[model samples]
Target: MSQHTPPSPVKKGKELILDITTAAFEGKGLGKVGEYAVFVKNTAPGDRVRVRINRKRKNYAEGVLLELLEPSPIRISPKCRHAGTCGGCTWQHIPYEKELVYKSGHVKDHFQRIGGFRDISTEPVIGAPEPFYYRNKMEYTFGDRRWLTDEEVQSGRDIADRDFALGLHVPGRYDRILNLEECHLQDPVSFRILDAVREYALANNIPPYNTHRHEGFLRNLIIRNAEHTGDLMVNLVTSGENDEIMQPFSSWLLERFPEITTVIHTINDTRSPSSEGRYQKVLYGPGYIREYLGPYHFRIDPNTFFQTNTHQARALYDVVLGALDKVPVLYDLYCGVGTLSVYLSGMATRVVGVEVHAGAVEKARENAAENGVSHAVFEQGDMKDIFNDDMIRRHGSPDIIVTDPPRAGMHESVIRQIISILPKKIIYVSCNSSTQARDVALLSEYYRLERIQPVDMFPRTYHIESVAVLSRNDT
Candidate 1:
């Protein structure tokens, strides 16, 4: 028997000139090196670049940008100084107008390539109003060791004196964190809070959390602010819960920022970067803050799931509501915190929102109450398991279903259950187009594609939020 051998690695230090066309699925510039697809990082469509081949495979290759021979006309200067190091805003270099074009192309590509949908019409992406400072929420990490610049390290700075750093993560480096002076994506107040908290922790000798050793005082700092309302929430996440230990810091924050409405402290013993806590307590004021979406007012908790971009979320919700007919009953499946369900409660006679997280359901109910939405109620259980005969009887049948699922999209079982229910309309909203396309393909058997609205919820990022409206197809 003959053994199959792996292809030889492309020689290192190899430079190539490539004419790029469109950005690939992985957010890299796609080019051809003699019929072989080569992905170059940080290059945009219409860019001609000199790149060095770093990795190669049987069918494709990856390159790193060495020099720009010709720059794309749509390219512009990024707002953030840390854009060179931080991974969050990759497309900031591209003009916002052109960014929308590429994002639209990416969505249509997903429907065609993944869902195998032919001639699917995609509307132009709804661009963000303000390209900068649109994010209402921002999280900064604490690191015991600071990631130094070429100048900083060469100047012979002592590691111990400048070791403690709290800022954004350096791309692809787990342990390294670049100290962010300012971030353009979030409000300027968030930067002030970041700096203040860092100074306080440094003076108090609070050690930054070390991911490798799993020991430290401070872990993460999260700031949430309202765009419409001036309400702000500051959440200090630590390794453990100690009221006395957090009392001084929380007191200082409230004293410093008179505008801060709420202060929260959460303890997470786990190693993951999640703010989902082992335990939490309200240090000052209420445990949550208020944010408005349309006429409804939502009380967002520390670990609560709220849309990051405040203004764009409302626009996306508007698109979601516009696609559907006024139905008697609405079912919001995989509903985290019931944002959409509450939004639909005004139009529908009865609204039922189902979520797996009990805490989120509690908050959802609170939201419904806050908005005086008496017609809406929340059900807490696994959708696939609880979405049976009894569950339907309890909540009544849904005339229209709106599912805003997680990035993994809906499970096969959930999809089948939804189809079995056979609602007149299905409004699918997703952050991940790839998984969404798969779910759409499954629903295509019973429902016909009606409208595709892609909203740019996250600007300057490769991510896209698309809404698909489906109507019943009676054969």
Candidate 2:
């Protein structure tokens, strides 16, 4: 007898009521329609929501939430008014404890699915002490096109100056900016500074850079605050240098906010939309601020790459340090500003940090010198190009290797080099778990995954930082 296959329960462009049963990776909510999985965004598990199937596939479907028929029991009111709309925080509505569970589960699931590991040891995700007001840096854009919310459009209020917006870009809409009145990611003082700058720009008729025409003055405003030290920096990126505008503006800003320790003016005359400048000039006080992590102090310039969340960075480092023993030599890959090298220098006989950016390598050396550590050295070269046998010989063979690559994760060539070197222990720190799992799978031939520790460096968001410790099989 032949059996007939049933059709899909949901159809493209069709609306249906779905009960979210679980959470999926990347802040998606998972629901099933007749055993067929449906993924919806901006929803929580145990939520009864009305969803419209936007994209249909043979196995699963993607949906957009239309209405929340019933809120989940684990859901809570978001602290920020822009929680659902802003691209900054995704799991704001979910309870923080539940969020940590989801994040930890995500790490385990990645290792199982991507790395093909079944019985790897996984630790509970370490939660942040404070969720809101944790970010040390905030970068805002100046846009001419403001995105209006549904509430604003429904109220029928006459909005003024729709061409001016001084906040973050709308999610999935790079050209449209949402005029944020408040943001919880950074401290309260950041919002105050944001408002002050917006008011000043509107009052003085300073034009925001237009991406389409590539003609305007103001581009981006970046704020950096020291978590341990009470220092603050404000970096203003503009299309051109105009002393007539900046001289008075800096004076007024400093006068208004005396807590602001430094103000920098960066110029980008070209059409590129990058916040980075061609050259920068100090408008007030010093051009850089000092930040402290553990016993070491780091000089943070406008372009310097430092950990965004300061409080949890210490905890994350503690995890790395806990897994280390007194070693003859340690190699830090993609080491920006030598934070890890300096932090772990106390236990290692010598530390070598390699980075691609010349500026970051210079800052790393300066930090090492400032910390009075002569045992650590910073080198400048692309990891794939310089991490070879010659480089390994120049710097003694490392007993242990610690790598903290970017979100894109480490390059395959660099991973191959590490495998060839066969260090006794490799500590992998990554902000993205999927790529980390893939890299670990690639190294599974010679190394055994010892432990995976997930740290919630960023709360109220789906982003997670994980530290994977592995040891050589023979050792």
Candidate 3:
């Protein structure tokens, strides 16, 4: 809890030594300089290392690992070749089991420190069945140049400067690609799809997109393969319609691979380009892919937001269902595509799902009807505004409320609205534990935290998806 101090006068390029002391903000792993906490990367709570000051600030300092004179006991060698470069798995150096412990502790610590909550339990984190190659989706970029390590540059060979693809993207660099042979974070199917795409693009003389120049045939290659069901969706983001090129590629793909049910191409012809919300074109086969979860089948498009780990998603959803405890009337807020409601439609007497996206609401209705579910009703509107007295009177006040909010968690106004309704049982699923903890603290005035389960939805990463059930307490 120490504040950052001004850095001493040192050469800009000179390496300064510091002993790793404690954990800092965002679990960057902290080191100290004369009682001041210096946020350093790749070093844990207790470790000694020589870090070269990269950027000095009055508040904090950024440094690179010049030499690890002594490594921490918690540090483990990363398995992936592109671990540090890909910017995907930041905490891979930490041991697998230890990573869960640290992540869970990190969530609890943030809640206790920031959310003003004292009753939060630091329970054993629920880990994934398969730690490695568990991710069902991976988005690999197509870049012009590759980034090289110091060792490659010191070898007197232009290894990175050569014309090649740098597998995944670097942390901050938009155009620079980090060449990777294999990323263990994804399943073998992901690697296969990536390799095939890279080979096909290279052989066809297609150029990777240069974000700076805004030119090239290829932009992004996103692969999604479900674990429960072997459904594959490949989204190829390009500049514009290239049917002449995509026609043959599509044929070649479907001829050889039947797993790729959906092959899509999206066009982004704008000065300020983005991957989100752009209208995608269906090149071949179906426009969407289907993912089976227990009794429900989820149809996913390119832009749909589904959990990365399909295996653990079942566990997360099960926790939500368990919180309902067979309530007759249930309300699901922020129910994207009505996944939860669709999954629990059989158990509940009637389920009401509220969402913002009109298209998603339509899809949710279609999905529910497809599954022959007659007890579910969906409406497209703002959750806070739609939960009025009229709507409540029609749908009936929910005995159980299940909310899966975004990373920012529920807005203060929405929390107040929920408090006004005051359901018998509340199940909250959150991607950001800090925000969830804050909401829980606010709701603690009316409800008590019953059982909190931390599900490792994204393995090999520091993110945790937690489900907290709160029951109304008699004061």
Candidate 4:
């Protein structure tokens, strides 16, 4: 959008070798070619690489890494061979220390540029204790067409032999999956489970679902593990009913991996797993597992939203809870499972959690009663609808409010509603800082940015989770 900048250096499909000066937003490498900015994927701050111009825009260009001529001083050899191909762990090559630096930069840039705020303090990113194997849940896709390496293509290997793959989706290619030899993000037992499932599906001739044709037996394989309890839940998502095929396989998994405490068969009749995946039968053990956040225990259903990394999540919650000073009445917007409100119920006279999902509200009530939290209340309704002035006057004003919205951030109407019923403090937790910054900008009219703590929930990746405390400007 800057008029003084020069045109892009290369046209679409052109190739160039450039020196990457810094990391950009979205985990890409930033470089300039004669005042023309270029963003190349799979690169580091000091990397010098050859790139192919994948897309040409008016102000900037997008590129794909073709060759790495020189590695960054901070770059380390990626532990996993499928680092770039798997589309997970985009920052695995960068040193963990440098990764923290870049993550801090991301928060600062988003606030300064997007929110137009210059004085917010962005503390150093809170690093994960164990960077690798930190993720508690991983979903492996089942594709009939497995992605082949360049060497395999060149070697004239039989295409039929490479037909089936139960691994990660190829970046931007949904029809193919890169069969994982090993993955570092989850427990190695997860990789063992992947191998076992793949082997069983192949031996039984259970066809992998084709996203294009929308016909197959196996669609997706989701695995979740309780980090502290070492309890595992394996959910085999299928397109149609094949109890005979899945029943035996689920039993085999429970027998083979004693660590696997639960196995659920999710019969998904719909095309996409996200739209229709539900727990049809608990083949082994309980259908859900309990994850502990401090003394509070949460019954985590396989399909529900729980923090993927529990260790860093605790740190984030502690930061938010520590910021709240006065709470006679508290309102938690976008309160999934009412975890935050439940965690702070004892401190407040009454804690009201507002969520749109009815099932989640039901579960939150169950969780609250299970934890002996009598002061917390959950209301299932749209935030915009429930956060009105009449409702505020009836329920009484809240001393403090906390919201952790989706990546889209709080809607403008919801933000305005919050401004109307201004609380003493607003604790905003978000995964997408870009949208968070925009929303914070709107609230800046009545609230002052007090503190920002960036927590790395997902390590070895570009994603960041931030908890921001905004004080009432009047207060």
Candidate 5:
């Protein structure tokens, strides 16, 4: 196949009768359009469809569903009404069991094909206990326009181009909203609370924030609920215009929904592309939300980073701990708020957590103090700087290293430092499997890939979180 192909006219506005060839680009179904391959959403291998080309790239094309000429046997009707538009669950149309199988293969494929580590043995992907309602965290955007069909728009209903937030933003379009009635990915409480909040906003004449003009009363809403503990945190992203809008909103939420233990507001004045909660204001309850994982209780703020799936997150934490075994001195790199550090402190004689964010480090210290954990220590600095010999002498060379880096994966320098340290065992937890595999390949010289297990942190989405255990190979 040619690496580059000229744009050719697909039938019916670049809509081609294409058959899915294989999985490509984050495990989406791939088909050919002229010489270039087309990535189709909610498609599987052997599926034939007439797809509408959206964006034409040099080597591939992005397409949408026009008509399923011959649907794959694996295709099933998605449960959610907003499945295609919500952007939360792209693989809802694909069977749940099949999705797990495909994800496991996807990780293996990324290592073999992309990372050049063909011999890496991958175990069967571990699935979530409950696929639906597994997500403990959800951040929903507010838009001023409710997306309606052309037929409905023509019926003289004064709806289109009006100031109103439908619900969450559609995949690409920022101006439009998908109007999610209920998301199956989140718990039933989330659905009810979202609906209630939307209704309350509409009733109170609180306008949805316009991303384009940066005007409006409300911008975003985040809901975090713990699975083990029935604790909830609601963070409202607002325009920072008035305290009036929040008084009633917060009052009503606290009174009506007693489960909401932490209700807060964040003033997002900057027109940045970040969805994070900023300049927080406590409306009700405490400054943080609480959750129980095993013997530990975690208090997380709106900006606090907690694993998405609470149940599976515990499992993941256990995997990391098991991989580490019982190292005398351990290091937790990229440790956000030191969740893992606090949990494994008792197991190890001493635990040192290295994080880049100062705020996270403060929170980690607070958590350690609150938990009465004295063996663990948290240092706020770039891991590259903190992993030096001097620091190693002070904290002792980490017998085992447990790092959970960001999606871009660990820095090459950090990886080199890890290899230099030569920890007895390295538990690499990654949200992006491709990057994880790539890093593992780089460390293949010194470390042996003991096991790679894919954990479905975010179900129904293409993203896969994997825990790869690496041990030093004695030649």
Candidate 6:
């Protein structure tokens, strides 16, 4: 028998008016057109918008918001002037309360739909105390091509020098950059430095790096601020080392803002656009700055991976710490720089940290040593390879396992290993809920899902950090 399928209600390049009924994940708005779902960006619930369908699929379609016919009642003015254009903070226009609601709902929906869990215990989301200027780190790219906004084009103003931009990449366009006037994510001093750097580059006639040509004087600028310790670091990534340009620039910058604790110049001779360089030279101060999570202090290098949100990270770690009871031994999987491992060392007699990056492993060892944490040891290798019986025999079996894998989530082999070992409790901390739910589903038979605590680590964005507690089934 041949079955007939109906055609889609919307077509590409067609314009239609829709009343947004609800909010969806990734800062999208959902609306229906005769039983067909359409997704639009930069829209909120209770809004009527004119959308141009750009992508059409079998059941749903994606559109671009062309005009906002009616604004949502709950809509709030965004703090940043670059609100809708900048991709860093997508939900800035929506109220912070509504943003929290959407994030919590998304986590719950992922568990029910992806994990196939009919009934799940979920706690209320913990919102950040200070939503703006909470980021400890900010990365700005140097591009030769500048992206112009629609407003700028319509104004008919004489826009000069469309090249040499020092800001974030335009959404979905890697080669184009939007010259950022102001950003509310990092400290105000960081933006002041950014503007000063841009002025210096322009005055010195420094050309930005071209993605297509791969040749320029400026590459990227990275700033890291220690919230608790008040230490600041500035990392300048360039195509090559030029003492002629760097020496005077560093002196001028330091003279203007003496609060800069350290300055590093990194050289990236490769063609890749990554900010990480081949090697770095310390232009001023020590090569590293110190940060404090709680009572413990950590040395942060230019390339080290630390939590971006310094304030909210304490809240996120509190969730992980609250889920645990004292145990003889604990295993911290994917433990980068041993932050959580060292943090949780107080509750366990011995903690074994496993990470893939050797450099991170070395830093973890250093951090543990710096904090006088003698009971914690870090092993460098892939989780799937190192988490076998041999390693278990070397450093006694774990009573508890805490796994925090990347966005792709844990590998199936790691899941199988956890199931085989069958620890008493598993604390899974994840940044992506969909992948976390899938991993949880894999261990459904051996472990029972207890509850999940969602933390707003990065506010103004769709990203979330959650800690899922699972206990081994007694039966």
Error of 4 at 362 (Å): 1.5
Give the 10-residue window scoring lowest on summed lDDT in candidate 2.
Answer: 78-87
Instruction: Please give each candidate's TM-score.
Output: 0.92, 0.96, 0.91, 0.96, 0.92, 0.98
Q: Please identify which of the two predictions, 1 or 3, would achieve the higher TM-score against the true structure.
A: 1
Judge candidate 4 against the unseen true structure and give its global Cα lDDT, from 0 to 1: 0.87
Instruction: Report how far residue 16 has shifted in candidate 6, in Å.
Output: 0.4
Q: Which stretches in model 3 have alpha-carbon errors above 4 Å?
A: 1-14, 21-27, 55-59, 160-166, 254-258, 276-278
lDDT of 2 by residue, 20-89 (tens): 9988988999999989999998899999999999999999999999999999998899888888886889
Prediction 5 TM-score vs. true = 0.92
lDDT of 4 by residue, 4-89 (tens): 85444689999999899988877899998888899998899889999999999888899989899988888888999988788988
Sorting all predicted structures by lDDT, with the top scorer first, yields 2, 6, 4, 1, 5, 3
Candidate number achieving the greatest TM-score relative to the actual structure: 6
- Residue 382 lDDT in candidate 1: 85
Pull out the clashing pairs in model 5: 143-165, 144-164
| lDDT for residue 389 in candidate 6, whole number 0-100 | 89
Superior candidate under lDDT, 2 versus 5 = 2
Once all C-alphas are superposed, what RMSD does model 2 give against the true structure?
1.7
Looking at candidate 4, the ten consecutive residues that score lowest on lDDT are: 271-280
lDDT of 3 by residue, 1-475 (tens): 8997555654346577877866553546677665555677767766788888777766567778778888888778888766655778767777778778777887788678766776677667889878888877787777778777566778987563355573776777867877667888777777777777777877888887787887876777888877766778888877777889887877777776777878888776664546542578887767877888788887787877777888888888887776667778888899988888898776679999999899889888888887888899998888778867778889998888888888888988788878888989889889898889889889989998877788888777668888888999962
Error of 6 at 11 (Å): 0.5
Q: Give the runs in model 2 whose Cα sits over 4 Å from its true position.
A: 1-8
**How many steric overlaps are in each model, in order?**
0, 0, 2, 0, 2, 0
